[model samples]
Target: MGGSKKLIVCGGLFLTLILSIGATAPKGIRLGKASYRKVTISWQAPDAMTQVAHYKIYRDGTELGSTASLNYTDETVQPGTKYTYKILAVIVGGGNSEFSSELPVRTLKSASFENNQLVEKVVDSFHDTPKSDLNAVSLISAIKAGFEALLGSNISFSVIDENIVTSVVVEELNWINTVTPELTETERLAVQSEIDAMMDSSFAGNSFDHMYINQKLTQLGDEHWGAGNRTAAELFYEFSLNYLSNHESTVSCSLARLAYFAKSHLTQDSSCADISESLSKAKACSERFFDFFPNSAPTSTYAKSALSQPAAWYFSYFPKMLEYSNYDALFFSTAYETAKRLVAFDPADKNAVQRLKRVAAWELVTLQLRFVDEKGNARTGSVKICNVSAENGKRDLFHGDAYVDEREFTLSNGTATVPVYAGHDYSISLNVDVANGNKLKFELPLFKYEKNKLVSYDYLTNSFTETPSSQSRTDFVISSTAYPYNLRADRGIDVFDLSWDWVAPPSFTTAGFKVFRGNMEVATVNKQTVRLPLNNSANEYRYKVVAVDANGNLSSTSQILTVYPGDQSQYSDFFEWMNRYFGDSDIYAGDDPDNDGVDNYHEFLNGTDPTKVPGPTPYAGPRGFYELTLEWDAVSNVEGATYQISRNGTVVGTSSTTKFTDVNLVPGVSYIYKVKQLTPAAAATDWGLPNTFTTQKAHNYEHADKVQ
Candidate 1:
């Protein structure tokens, strides 16, 4: 029996040794590329006696997940955060290895780069061009080439080649001086003076230097133009365009100026390009500028001059027109209604036809207006186009005539289309009558549209704005009030899965919802639920939801909800500051739970319990017949604290020593005083307690006056 037991023990020890040898930890664990939202960690496969099945990843001392590959990407990461990661390899059989050495990784800090919507809009607008035409292709290539030169180049924001830039500037100056037709003596001196001034200014080898160079060239061009020196003006303007090539609006402005020069002067000189070429270049740049910055196109100084010339010049070149005066009216019509006529008018010149169509589509947008009642039910109403003011210094579209300027439309259904000229602001009123003979009028002011679409209104910001997921829903009468109801939040270890039901009206059909963290949009989804990652460093977070319909109209945002994630034990500071004082009560920063006249924020700043209201303890009495004295215990555990004494609710005086005296008081009269402690240079706390006191009456009067 002893021999059999020894054999069994020896066999068990051998099996354990084998298992230990088969399980091996991952080796050479290192970080791959890390971005703002994700971190990639890779490791060399471990050498195990059995085939490896998978690898396990642990982040910040917890198991994140298992991956079958050697590299794993942890997407649940925040920007500018540090995390510890470790890896372990598991054999195909069953045994797992010990954790690998912990590796510290940090995600790249985030900044405001080019937003996704701008990129999409730029690309989409570019694709709208005639790809087959050589001129169109070259124009598109120029845009792509511009981006490549800026982004693909080795230029660094932190560094610049000053010597090279100085050399280029000197070469440009020399070229300007050696023009074939030398400037007049006065012109020469003036140009030299401007050049000297430009040389005197500092170039800081940064983006500001680029701006300075471009602006100086433009200024020189303007001066020459003002002096009627066309040659010098052309020279400076061309150089300015080259300097501002990467700047969309400024470059477009330069191109537009050159185009105008070509048209006005009909200059076909060796240096001045032909009218068609100049206008074509201007059209391309202006379209790009408007596409990327639709909001700023109306107000931008560059856009005003850049976008105003293309459509008119292109239309003027057409063969046969109804009349020169009717061109504006024809271009303002809807693209769908005018496509056949426009195409037939210039079928041979496809490029011309396309250009006119593009400009017309961009210039005049068909704004869709939806009128609804308080419950989102469609309401029939008349929209009177009361006023229209052009931003680019043009005459108003409407005149005093009701059919011309003061146009009104009846909404047969709840929706109607209005012609909104681009670069113009409008004031329109919607008049709707309710069931009880009551009429409602909504006057919308400073409203504009772009590319036949109205901008989405952000209730959170209470303004017009755009995001990648937020589409233009057109203009609407009923303010979105269908807030998401019965919202529920399920907190995971590092995420919150939020689910809510829409108290949607019958007329509302939800297309998607935008999720926000505070004022920042976190995510957008088509469903009523979203799973959002929580910042491990922060215990509390605020979130809200806004629903969007198929037409892009947004519902009123849900009430801001505050949530605390993870177990309470994780945040020791929260416990020490909040739980220790309030004892398991859920307290918000803005709430005054104790009705102490001080909000929790001030209570926290004052280092007082939010749940307790300090009661007044009368401690003042009369010192003499007409004088009163006040004293109180000083507040403890606070540094540089002072006291404010109030007499009858007015600040009588401030005391640092906790003792104050009131003199010149009427005898037998009571005076109320309130005392509150204040921290240095901070908001004052609530009054602790009110103390009332009366001065001693003059009981023993002098037995006799002067006569007695």
Candidate 2:
């Protein structure tokens, strides 16, 4: 009986759910190609709809001009916005069906065949260079090719996208533009002109050939669909290998790539391909570059180049051997023998021997860095890295300018090389005061770096992985030019009303802003703007902002700005109040001791007591129209008190009630008002506040609504 009752309850609940849903969601909803700033969505009518009056379309939850058909043409969207669309079936009887399935789309930038070939030319040039002289341009160009090859038909600025490629490009451009000490106005303008021209024509005209893009998309689809047969490490390693390999690696390390692929493939199905011969070929090839040590004086730059540049490039694929199931042990035994040979060739080759051991152990060591922003967009600047003392409790790794001069390094192209010490802990720090001036430092674990590897921190997922961990820096500028503004004090207590529009920090690790008046930090504010208390006699103020990253890493930026003190807002009235009530040096306009949102300076401007909370209501309704009528939310809690209203500092009227009328004020002019509550004892009614309203010009009688 209980089981029957439960089944009945379940059946009733399912029926209720079906009734509430009302209609089935549309099937076969599809998004068309969205490459040129337009998208189309189509779907079949839901099977549940009956007597459908018309179909309604919605974009981004808002109607983008509804349609009565089953499809939508959205032409108003840009490349930057990803739009989602859905359809609903509205009936003649005023009821509506459940919304159809949603389809989201975003336009992708395309490049022409010639542009693609040109990109290949750049990559070829980069790949042909010797590793020592092969700057970021070579590596980045190669990586760019890899991106075009491996990136699926997806639009995102993720770690897996082309952010690393563009970051290098931006770094190179910045290096060209920013003069080490400073850039003059003329030089800056010249660089800016060049950049504008390049943006207008150089990159904008490029688009991928449709067939080629389709081929890549198809390839990506195949790989993704078949990825379940492999391990996550193997899949990720394959992606890394495909993205990092250029023509040179393709030609020379063909067996290496194939053997690695086969090794992983054989784990699932051994009957597919014979990889034993390919694996042997790869081991023999790896031995060719295993003997030379770049750190030692092996006069043969040829041999060093073979090992560190082209050869090291090839051997870097050695990690995939470990990622394989069977080939790892097989490859490690051979690599260990190669290490023994290096020690035999040079009895003093301790480093080479250790590297061999690392090769066998699969240890990670920092080889290169690609600095980027919090969004995984590459950054172009110098970063300070330090080797923290294993003993010192201070961990003073990156508080302020420690080893800035000694360990300072800028990315080449968008990369920098650091010596790999197998077991040493390191820290990278920078000042990132873009939002609120701050400094941060990130401590790195030695365990994270694999031998001859790169940082691959994914900004999209906010995750870190060794070997291709996309490195990033906080987006911030500490100089004067960060969204500058004019500084004008209220003259009563030398408190300047600061309204500076500054750049927001790109990272989430910032603590607050530290305001410096010349040499000393005058105040700290976490927000963009704060009332800065200036010296009574000083005529100008200079401020800088710094940003702090999550790992306490700090990024310092240029671009400074300065604002001079202008005429006081209330030069006459405020000074008089301050001087008459207390010494001019004691009470400051910015000081709000009572924790009211209204500052003491604004209080003096309105002749209200600053010591009390809710002191003489601060700024009431500053809203409403031409020949404007203004109103306020009345102050209660006071007993039998009347109110005094003032317009433009002149006593206009007094009412026993909380209402007033100011007639015929000139249009297009500004007016200020204040209200004070009056007690029956005739004491200072000390309630109410100041507000401002400006009248608009009279409208022509063209439109009946009369709204501007």
Candidate 3:
């Protein structure tokens, strides 16, 4: 009975295996012509299988290797090889289904005359077909031939309906709507005809009303307003407007153009009231245009231009009336806002920054002067001022002692005083540094002085002078004439040598001096001669000279002297080599040191030459340890040598050696190593190309325990 049970159990297992194979059978298969030299076979397995171990691929009854994915490529098959392939779906339970239906496949071959000749013949025959005999057959043949040609040449082609083609062409010509006045009558007529035809075509909806309205508007916008049929153009534009009143986009564009023309033509009119009304209408139209075409570039540009005009018109009235106070506030506000917007729109707009500065200067006329002492302490002084009533001008106030109170003053402690004039130009000077001989002399308008009272002459002028007061007032004064020395080295020169001429003011005698190197004052120079010590390693250096006067008056250091190193004669060669061989500057500086298993410098110091060619250095004993000895030909003019060893492009060790034996390396592994040589001048030679070697696998008896 026990023997019988064993037999039944074994039979049951066999039956289960067969059932698993049947359940895991592939349900579908597919094939496609993807490329040459390969064939793809894809299959879908039955859902009853939980895990598919692999699909066994077969061609012409020959078994190929199995893969887990449903898709497989028979890469080993040669091009033009014809075969029938099927898949055997295998389950993880050691069972597989029978072969799938055989699918015929042939690998692609190189182009031959047979394929091209047939396609050519077909196309030529189709083209030769009589027009009366033209049919689907000829059309299909021609299309197929074209497709074949395109595919073989690796080019792309697409088929589109007539509607898309017409739309593309019409949209491309929209820019012609804005023609310049310079266009001749013939050119204008031709353009108008073209626009009419495009609008009348199916592409633009064949709307005759739209075409008529557009033509009328275009006539009004063409040529110089007064020169070319102004009456007729106005009539057309009016008629166009009546029809396009409800058409927001068209109506807005027409109104804006009309307003622009009116403004330009009525510039010399006795009254600008009508022009202002036209501008208001234009602004309203622009608002409507924006609503209709919010993202349109042309519409947005028109809106911005329209908005800018009203402000300009208002400001123009003020200057004409000479009502400076009334218009001053308006001008300042408008200028400020416009400048801010311009800056926000185009951060790099220098014109906008300059405009802002000008507006700020206009506002400076309202500032009051305040005098301060050496410690920024306030001082009591009476200033008499006067103003000059010119357009954008102010009167200058003078003191009883002939000091100009209209000017701004700067104290030695860094405080400033600027006079204010409402609408006139005033010359204001700042009394800088009173206690010490240092003084800052600057002249700014009452308005501009507020913004920059400490500087002399608004950053644009020269020859600013200040007189010292005998009242024993403590103020910081700056000399008007301060010229700093500038030094720059010639290119390709590694070291910089510099000298300059210094002239001291007659009122001030030279007391002590300091020479500045970088940010630190390196030495005191009583005499003019000074030698600057520099490390040739750096590319550039800057120096300055500080001079002190006898009365404790300190002047800012001389202008910075810049020095550049190296006579770049070798730059061309260096750049050429860098481009041709290095390809990248960063690549040469990568951390890989040695061509061997060591750092380049370390290898050199260990008596190993880094520039040596790499080869196999095998160990003689157990434990798979080997020492590699690297050596190379000595480079001429090299004072001493440093070496690095690299394994597989990674630094593993460095030594000063003709050869280094690497003992810790594993056997049976391939390694690529290279070396670099360092010269006495600290320049490094390019690493030699790598050499590859594979260590022999250790014998089991050599290190039997380690191997196991």
Best by TM-score: 3
RMSD of each: 37.1, 36.2, 37.5
Q: Give, for candidate 1, the lowest lDDT window spanning 10 residues.
A: 14-23
**CA-lDDT, candidates in order:** 0.54, 0.45, 0.44
Expressed as tens digits, the lDDT of each residue in 1-708 for candidate 2 is: 332222111111111111111012224566533433455666776566477778787888987766667766666665335677777888869889888666655443322221333333333333223223534444444444443443333223232223433443445435433533343333433653665466446333222222223223223323433544222222233232222122223222332433344344333223212333444444454333332222334543333333333223223444344332324454445445655555555556566655555454432333666655545544454556665534333222222232221276666555566543344345655423233533322323222345534445532233455433343222222232232222223333475554433344444455555555655666666665567655535554665544434465434432233556566664667767766656655567666765667786687865666665542443433334434444554555656766677787788777666556566677667888777766564334454556777776556677834564
- Candidate 1: give the clashing pairs: 398-405, 399-405
Model 3, runs deviating above 4 Å: 1-239, 265-285, 288-374, 377-524, 528-708
Once model 3 is optimally superposed onto the true structure by TM-score, how far is the C-alpha of residue 475 displaced, in angstroms? 14
Q: At residue 511, what lDDT does model 2 achieve?
A: 56
The order of the candidates by lDDT, greatest first, is: 1, 2, 3
Stronger candidate by TM-score (1 vs 3): 3
Q: Which lDDT tens digits does candidate 1 get at residues 299-367?
A: 345554344445555444321221222334433332223333334444564644554444443254456
TM-score of each: 0.25, 0.25, 0.27
Report residue 648 deviation for candidate 2 (angstroms): 7.2
How does model 2 fare in lDDT? 0.45
